[model samples]
Target: MTAKILRTRLDCVDYQEACDRIQNWAIQRNSCYVIAANVHVIMTAYWRKSYQQILNRAALVTPDGMPLVWGIRLLQNAQQTRVYGPDLMLAWCDRAAQSNLSIYLYGTTETTLVSLTRHLQQRFPSLRIAGSYAPPFRALTPVEEMADRDRIHASGASVVFVALGCPKQEEWMARQQGNLQAVMIGVGAAFGFHSGEVSQAPRWMMRFGLEWLYRLITEPQRLWKRYLINNPAFVVLFGLQLVRGLIKGQ
Candidate 1:
């Protein structure tokens, strides 16, 4: 099921169900994209129509943050749990190993990719990583883009884990549908976190929805506006939505 939180569709899927769906898609070689929607991602989509369309058309838009999980529970289903990107990537890796599915890694720095690949192999010994590429940080030229696509296509990967981060990653995946014959998942910062290049919030903080606070404290310069501005705006907008729902129910 899905719920509209601040006008963005969030799938009310638990971790296991999400992994199963992605695995099935990979096995079938379907061209699709999965989005791990957090508060920042949701708020961005709420304000940007183009981005919202990208998310709405996604094969799966998992509630990746506690706020989204809570929002889905309040608005739609009470059983919704977070299908976080980093954790989801790990789960998929384990499943891929067990099933002998091949995966390709895209985005992030080459150094981080090397570390992440090592970590994944160390954790999931049987996992077949078809290939990996770290594109230039700037926008890719049309020819460059085609080359990248060809590279991925020729690699014969069933699943491509894209770590380009939120809006950009989402947009890239949307453009690749039909053009890319594999499941493309926009996993945002999973590469960095998994590679140990970046720190993650404690499990306690994540469970209590304080992961944002931890991120803000750690990367204040980059994340302050996102958390401070977008978060409060989301609360106000979602609160209004709840009020309207209540009024209609009454």
Candidate 2:
């Protein structure tokens, strides 16, 4: 099936085709940045200037949320699946392993990294992990950033998966691209989810667009503000954007 395009400023494509298309882009063009544009990610792209720059600079941005897929359907009639971070990690891992492309996981706590590597080895038997690094909790200074850049370059990895979460990962990816010679993907929460440190919602919940509800129930303290505050507000804001677009078009 052909990937349908959204009318919005950004390109909206499905996960599988996106995977093939991006890999092709990188192969033919010799460079590309593949960004997973989920609801939270899209909201960040919508509201934040720097984040928008980082995303817009990317070679490709796939719709990573069901609502976002539906939202695109509203404007472009495209049927796109959510190219979630966790699933994308698994997808790329499977592909990279087959293609002999080395990978580096750069984020999460030490425990999470250990578990993630262990799980990847078990799940994808031939996955060649070029390297893995767990950075400090606090923000990294320029020196620290440069050191990280050097580390990735030395590893000889063709794919660097940055799991620093949201804006941090996005920021890191944008900055490290020139320094690190590889495809840098900001895969938020994928490391944790795959490592079993974080639980994913049920398929039904996800299909019905209630994954956030399930997550909120699981970890209220950490995600209450995100769900109760940001989620609804994002809907309102996006709705307003749609209305505003309609008005301008008229």
Best by TM-score: 1
Question: Mind giving the per-residue lDDT tens digits that candidate 1 earns over 1-250?
Answer: 7788887877778778888999899988999999999999989998899999998899999988999888888987978888999999999999889998999999999999999999999999999999999999999888888899999999999999999877889999998999999999989989999999999999999999999999999999999999999999999998999999999999
What candidate 1 gets wrong by more than 4 Å, as runs, is none
TM-score of each: 0.98, 0.89
Write down the RMSD of all candidates, one decimal each: 0.8, 2.9
List ranges where model 2 is wrong by over 4 Å: 1-9, 21-32, 244-250
Q: How many clashes show up in model 1?
A: 0
TM-score of structure candidate 1? 0.98
Best by lDDT: 1
- Give the Cα-based TM-score of candidate 2 against the true structure: 0.89
What tens digits encode model 2's per-residue C-alpha lDDT throughout 1-250? Answer: 2232222244655556666764664344333466777667766666687788888788667767777777777766555567776788788788878877778899999899999999999999999898999999789999998898789778877778888878888887787765666787778888989999989999898888898898889989987876777678778877887888799999
Q: Candidate 2, residue 237: CA error in Å?
A: 2.5
lDDT of 2 at 32: 44
